[model samples]
Target: MIEIAVSALLGAVLGTWPMYQHDPARTGRTSPSLVYTNQPNVVWKTYIPGSPSVPIAGADSSVYVVTQGGYLHKIHAQTGTLIWSFPIGGACWGIPALNPQEDTVYCTWAYDKKRWWQGHVYSVRSSSGSQNWEIILPGGGSWTGNHLAVDQTGVLYVVDCSNPDGMVNAINPDGTFKWSVPVPDVGGEEDLFALSVDEARAHLITGGWNSERRVICLSTSDGSHLWSVWTGSATGISACVDPSSGTVYHPGSDGILRAISSDGNPIWSANLSVVSTPALSRDGSMIYCPGSNAFYAVNSTDGSVAWSKPIGSSSSPAVDGNGNVIVPSSDGHLYLLSGSSGNTLWDVLVTANPLSHIACAGWEDRIWIFVTANDTVYGLSALPVEAKENLPEGFGVEFKSAGKSIYLFMPNDAQVSLAIYDAPGRLVQRLYDGVLSSGGHTFNPTLEAKGVYMAVLRYQGGMKSLKVIR
Candidate 1:
C-alpha cells in the first residue's frame, strides 16, 4: 500500500510539472497600437502673441499654461475649462516647474525696452489664482530664454538674461534667496539658456550661450562650482543627466549630441545634421531628439541608432506611460510615435505653426497635450483601447482541435500550453509546453478529449489566451 501511495504522489508531481516549470519569459499584455492619421480631435485651441517657448504643467486633472502674452491660464485637462488666469509683467517664455509639495509653480519671463533686458520670476499657488512670491531682476540685459531648475527641497535656480556678468540665483520655497552664484564671465554675453540638476551628486548642469560651448556642473548643496566641460557651440535647448550612468546628454547648436561622463569626460557623440534639442526617455533606455526632417531615437546605453521617422521640423518629444511619443512639428501637426519601434502612431494638426515647446501631462486614463500657436490648447482623450492596439501585427487568435491535432498561430514568440477540463473541472491533459516563436504552431492532441480545451501563449512583454474547439 505504501508503494502504491508513493507512486500516486510521484504521478501527481509529474502531472503538474509542466505548470510548475512554466517559462518565466512571459510578456505583459500591452494596449493595442494607434496612429493618428486623421485631423486632430482638437480639445481646445487658444491664441497667444509671438512665438511661445514654455511647457504646460498639470496637477489634479488641471493644466497650468503660461504664454508669451504674459498670461498664466489654468484650464481643465479634460474639458479645457478656463479655471483661472494670472497676468505677469513680462512675456512668459519658459516652462513652468511645479512643486506639488508646496502647491506652487515657478515660472520665468523676460521683456525688452530700449536696449535693456528685464526678467521676473513668479511663484503662484496651485489651489487659487494667487501669487506667493515674485522677484524682478536688475536691468542688465533681456532674458532671451527660460532656464529654471528646482530641487527636492523646493529651492529654485534661474539664470538671468544676456548680461555677461549675470549669475544664477537660488530662491527658497518662500521666495528668499538661499545663495547666488555668479557665472564666470565668458567674454561675450552670458547666455545660460538651459539647466539641469543631478540630485545624487548634488550638482547642477547649465548650458547654452557662452563664448565656447560648455556645461557647468555646479554644487547644488552649497551653490559652489564643481566642474565645467566645453563641448563646441551653445545652440541646444536642454541638458539631461542619466542618474544610473551619471552621463550628461548635451545637444549643441553645432547640430551634435555629446555624452559627457560624470567626471566631465567625453563618452560618445552623434550628429543629427540639424540643430535640435535632446529629450531623455523616462526609462533612460532611449533618447528622442528632433532632426531636420525626421525625429530620431538613439539607444541611451551606447548611443546607437534605434529608429527614426519622418515628421518635418520638430521640437522636443514627450513620452507617455504607454510609450507614445508626442512631438509638435513645423508642419502644424503633433506627431505621436510608438516608443518601441518609432512607428507613427498618430498626428493632430493644430495650426500652420506649432509652438517649439509643447507641454504634455498624463494621468489615470487621460493625456493632455498643449500647443501654443494662436494660443490653441488641445486636450485629447487618451486614444481609445482599440485605437491604441492597431499595430500591423496580427490581432485575434483562434484554436481548433480535430482528430488528434491542435493548431495555433500567435503574433510573437510565446510559451504555448494546453489546459483541459470537463463539465465539472476535472483535470484532463496538457498537450504541450515550452516557447513558441512567431507564426503557426501545432501539437498532437491524441489524449485531449473532445469536450473543451484552453490554449495559453505567454511571451516576453505580452500574453494571449485562446479557446480551442475540439
Candidate 2:
C-alpha cells in the first residue's frame, strides 16, 4: 500500500509538472508569425466624403483625424470606429494636433466668406468634442492651407497669410495671444505655405513662397529671431522634430531632406524628389521618408540612404514599435516595409486615394495603423513574427566554428534544440531543450563522435533543421 501511494503521487507530480513546464501565460503570448512578407490584414475601413488629410495625435488607443470638409473626427485606432465628429464651419486641410495630457485638440480651418477665405483656430476637448476656445484671424485673406503646430508647453503656433508680409503667431492654450513676429517681406510675388515647430528650443520653422525658398526658425517663447537658411526654390515642404534627439528634419521644395542640429547647424542632408517629412525609428537610428516614387530609409547620423523601394508616392511614413514602417501610397494600397532595409514585407489594397499619412499606436500586443480618405478612416493590425534560425524575430543569424565548440549568434530570441543520431538511426545525445535569447550562445561538441549531427530550431509556428558535420 505504501508503494502504491508513492507511485500515485509520482504520477500526479508528472501530470502537474507538464502544466507548469510551459505555462501558456508565460510563453504563449501571441507572437507575430515568421513568414516572409506577410500581407497586411486590414481590420476595418470606414468611408468618408472628400479627401482626408493625415491623421495625427494618437493617444490612449485613438487617433484624431481632420477632413477637407471642416470635419474633426476621433477614430478608434484598433477598430476604426468613428467615436465623434465636430464640424468647424470650414475646410480642415491640415491634421489636428493633440495635447494628450490636457485632453485637448488644436486645429485650424478655412472658409470662404463674402469671396474671402477666412481662417480660424479652435481648441476642443478630446473626450467630449466641446469647443474650449476659438480665435479668428484678423482680416481674412486667401487661405494658404497650412497646418497648426503645438509645442511641448501647450502653445500653438501658426502662419497668418493675411498680412502682405506673412506673420507667425504664438497663442496660449486658452486662446490668449502670447506673441507674433513678422516674416521678412519677400517680393509681393512670393507666397508662404507651410510651417513646423521646434518646441524644445522655442523655434518655429516655415517653408515655401519664394523663388529662393527658405526655412526660417523663430523663437516660440518670445517670437525672437533665431536663424534662417535658404533651401533652393521648391514647394510643399514639410518638417518634423526627432522626439528623442530634438533634431529638426525638413524636406525642401528643392527635393532635399536636411537634418539640422537644435542650434540650427546642418548635420546631414539627402537629395530626393518630393520627399515627405522624416519619420523617426523608435530607437532614433534611422529615418523613413517617401521619395518621389518610392520609400527610402536613411541613416539618422549622416543622412545616407540605407534602403529604397518603389512603393509610389506616399504619405508621411509611420514607424511602429517593432521598427516596421507603414506607408500609404496614392496607388490605393498600404505597404509595410522592413525598417532596416526598406524591403516590401506586405501590402494591402484599400479604396482609391488611401494615401493619407499613417499614424500608429500599440494596443493589445498589436500595432494599429489609422488610414484616412474621403472623410473615412481604416484601422490595420500588425503583429510581430517570431525569431528565425536562432536569430531574434525580425533579424538574421550566423554560426561559426572555433576548435571543438560552436558559436551561434541570433538577432532575436528563439526556441532551439539539438540532437545527435548514429548511422543506425538511434538518438545518442540531447544538447539543449529550451528557448534562447538574442545574441551568441556557445556549446561544446567534443563529446560527440566525428559524424553527422542535427540541430533543430522551432519558432514562429514553424521548424528548421540544420545538419552539422562533426
Candidate 3:
C-alpha cells in the first residue's frame, strides 16, 4: 500500500507529494487514472478591477488574488464575499505564494515613479490583510514572467527585473535580506522568469529571458553561485524541481525542454517550444508542456513524446484528483483532457476574455477550480455542490484544511467525540469529546509526524472516519 503523508496544507501541494513516487526512470504516468469527463458547473463568480496575471491561491476559508490594479483581495471561498483588500500602489503581474507553516502570503509588485523604478516584495499575514513584513526590491523593469517562490523553510525568493539587468533576492520569513545575486547580462538585455525551490536540496533554480538564455542554480543557504547551463534561445516561464531525485525540468523558447540533475549534469533535452512553465505529474514521471497552439505529454526520463494534441493558446496545465489534465486556453474556455491519452473529455467556456493560470482545491470527491479572465474570477466544481445532497441523512461530517488547521463541519448538533489515530490504528490524540452545536467546527491539532493518520468521529449513534495527512 502507498502510505500518503498528510499535512495541514490544502490543495495541490498536499495532494501531490509522496503519493506519487519520484522515480527518475519511471516512464509511465498515473495508474487507475482519474479523469473528469463532463463540463464542471460554475459555483461562484466575482469581478476584479484589472486583469490577473498570476494563479489564484486558496487557503483556510479564503481565496487570495492579486490584480494588475495593484490590489490584493482576499475573498471568502464558500461565498464570494470580500474579506479585505490591500493596495501595493503599483502593478502586480506575478502570482502570490503561500507558506502554510509561516501563515504568510508572499507577492511582488512594480511601479514607475520619478526617475527610478520602484519594486517591492510584500509578505502579508494569510489570515488577516495585515502586513507581516515588506521589503523594497531593487531595479525598475517591466514585470513579464517574474515569479515569486517560497520554500518550506519560509525563505522567499524573487527575481527583480526593475532594471535592464535583473537580480535575484533571497529574503527571510521575517522580511530580512539573506543574499542577492546579480543576473548576468546577455546581448543587451537580461531578465529572469520561472523560479522554483528544491528545499531538501537547498537549491534555487531559475531561467533567463534574454542573452544566451541560461538556466541557473544558486545555493539557497547563502545565495552563492552554483552552476549555470546555457539553454538554447530563451528559457521559458519557469522550471519544475523534483526534490526526490534532485532533477530540474526547464522549458525553452526554442521549442525544446531540458532536464538537468542537481549537480548541473545534463539529462535530456526534447523539442517542446513551450513559452510557459510545464506541469509535472505527482509521481514525477510525466511532463505536460503547453506551446503556442498545442499540448504535449512527454516522458520524464527520456523526454520522449507520450502524446500530443492541439489545445490552442494556454497557460501551464493542472492535473486533477482523477488524473484529468485541466488546461485553460486563451480562447476563453477550460478543457479537461485524459491524462494518459491526451484526449479531450470536456470543454466549457469559463470566461469572455483570456485567462490567467488556474488554481484548485480538492477533498475526496469534490474539487474546486478557480480561474481569472480579464476582470472576472470564476469558480467551478468538478463534482457539483448539489452532489452533497446524496449524503445520508443524520449528522454528517466533512474534512477541510488550509495552513495548519483542519476544519470539521457537523450538520446538526449532537453529543460528539473526535480522535486521531496513526496508520497502524494507534490513537495519536483525542481532539474533542463533548456535546456540540450545529455548524462548522475547527480543530488545530498538533500533527508533527510526516505520515498518514485517521480521524474518527462518533456522534448521534453514527460513526465516520477520514484519512488525514500531517
Candidate 4:
C-alpha cells in the first residue's frame, strides 16, 4: 500500500494529465460530490448574459444559472459553452432546479404590473431550450420567495409570500398542482429562508418563526405539515440533512449551531457565531462552517471543535476529495487548508470580494473549481506537481540536484531566495538571498541531517520546489 501511494504521487508529478470528459446528460446532483482535490483543472469560463449572483445549479452534465434579468441559461459543464438560453420576461431570484428523470428544469419568476406583483413558475425542457408549461402561483404581492425544492419524482415545492396569504405549493412535472398549504406570518418582513427536501424521510424541511413551529417538516407528496420543532429564536438558517446518519445540521441566528435527528430531536448544539450554511465532509466526519472573519471545522459526530483558522470575511467553505477544505475570503485569495489539521496548504489570489460559494466538480485527480466574481465567471484548475521547466518566455528558475551539489538556472537577472526544509516543513538551511545574474548558478550546502529535504526557488511572484534526499 505504501509503495502504491508513493508510486501514484510520483506519477502525478510526471504530469499524468487527466482528460477533460463529462456527460451533461447525467442526473442532477442534489449535493456536491465527495470527490474534490487540490488538483484543479480549469476547463473554461464564459461570461453569462445577465447578472447571475446566486449559486449555479447542476444536473445531467449541464449547469443552470438564472440571471437577474430573468434569462435562464443552459451551459455545458465541460466547455463552458452556452448550450441554450431563454428569457423569463421577469426577474429570477435564486437557483433553478433540474429534474433529469423528467427532462425538465424549474425556475421561479415574477413581474410587477399596475401595483400588483405577478409570479409564475415555468418548466422547460432540459435537452432543448423549449418551454413545456407555465403555472401562475397564488400570490397577489410583488415579491416571490426564492425557495424551490424538488423530489425524486420531479415534484417541486415552492414558496410564495403574497401579503397575508403566504403559501407553499406542490407542483407536478406537468405543471399541474398537487396541493397548497398556507405559510405563517404572511405579511411580515422576514426573509423567505431556504427549502430542502429529505427524500429518504419523505419530508420537506425549512425554517420559520411566524408559524406554529420554528422548523417544520412537511409531507413532500401532498404539502401537508408532518411535524415541526423550534430550535431557538434564530430564523432563516438553512438545514442540511444527512441521509446516511439521518441528522440535520443548521445554524441559528443567535450564534448557535444545532444538530437534530431526522425525527425532530436535538442531537447537539454548539454556540459558535456561524453565518453561513455548514458543509459536510464526504465521509460525514467533519462539518465546515464559516463565521465572521474565521472558519471552523467541527466534528460531525459530537459538534466538537476540531480546528479553527482565521481567514478574512469568507463565504461558506467547501471540502475537496483530498480532505482539503476550500475557503474563499474577501481578501482576494482562496485558501486551501488540510482537512485533518487545518494547516494552510496553498492560498491563491483569485478576485476581490469573492462572497459567492465556490462550485466543485469532477473526481479524483481532475476536480474543477467553478467560481463567479462580481461580473465574470472564472474556471480555476489545481497547480500540477510535475516539473515543466519551459518558462513561458519570462523570468523563471529551475532547480536540479546532481551528486552533492545543486544546480540553479535563472532566466533573467532577478532577486531570488533559496531555502531548504525537511519533509515536515521544518527549515533546515537558508542558502542565499540576493540578486543573481541571468545564468546558471551552483551551491553545495552540506547535508548535516540524514532525511528527505526540499529545495525551494523563490523569485518574481512565483516559486518552485524539488524534493531531494540527503
Model 1: per-residue Cα lDDT over 88-201, one tens digit each: 777776767665335787787776687566778888887687999888754356473465666545677776654565466777898888777666554223555566665533
User: Higher TM-score: candidate 1 or 3?
Assistant: 3
Q: Model 4: per-residue lDDT, tens digit, 356-444?
A: 65655432223356666675566665432322345421234556665577778887888987877542233568788999898898887
| Shift of residue 211 alpha carbon in model 4, Å | 7.2
Clash count for each candidate, listed in order shown: 27, 14, 13, 9
Once superposed on the true structure, which residue ranges of model 4 sit more than 4 Å away at CA? 1-34, 41-44, 55-61, 139-142, 186-191, 200-213, 232-234, 363-366, 382-470
Candidate 1: regions farther than 4 A off: 1-40, 49-53, 111-113, 138-145, 187-192, 201-210, 363-365, 383-470
TM-score of the candidate numbered 2? 0.68
Q: Against the hidden reference, what TM-scores do the models get? A: 0.68, 0.68, 0.74, 0.68
Local distance difference test scores for all models: 0.56, 0.58, 0.62, 0.60
User: Candidate 1, overall lDDT?
Assistant: 0.56
Q: How much is the lDDT of residue 189 in candidate 2?
A: 20
* Best candidate, TM-score: 3
Q: For candidate 4, give the lDDT of residue 230.
A: 72
Which wins on TM-score, candidate 2 or candidate 3?
3
Please write out the lDDT profile of model 3 over residues 1-470, one tens digit for every residue.
22223434532221111000111111112111123454677888887778754444433646777888888888765566778888867888777776634568777787667544567888888678888877776544434335666554556777765355657777888888888766656312245465666653333333444454677777787777788887665553667666557688776667777899888889998877676667666556788887787888889899999998887655777765356678878788888878789888888887777766776653344446667777777877664222344664222566555446667777777788777754222357889999888889888666776655556555663444445655
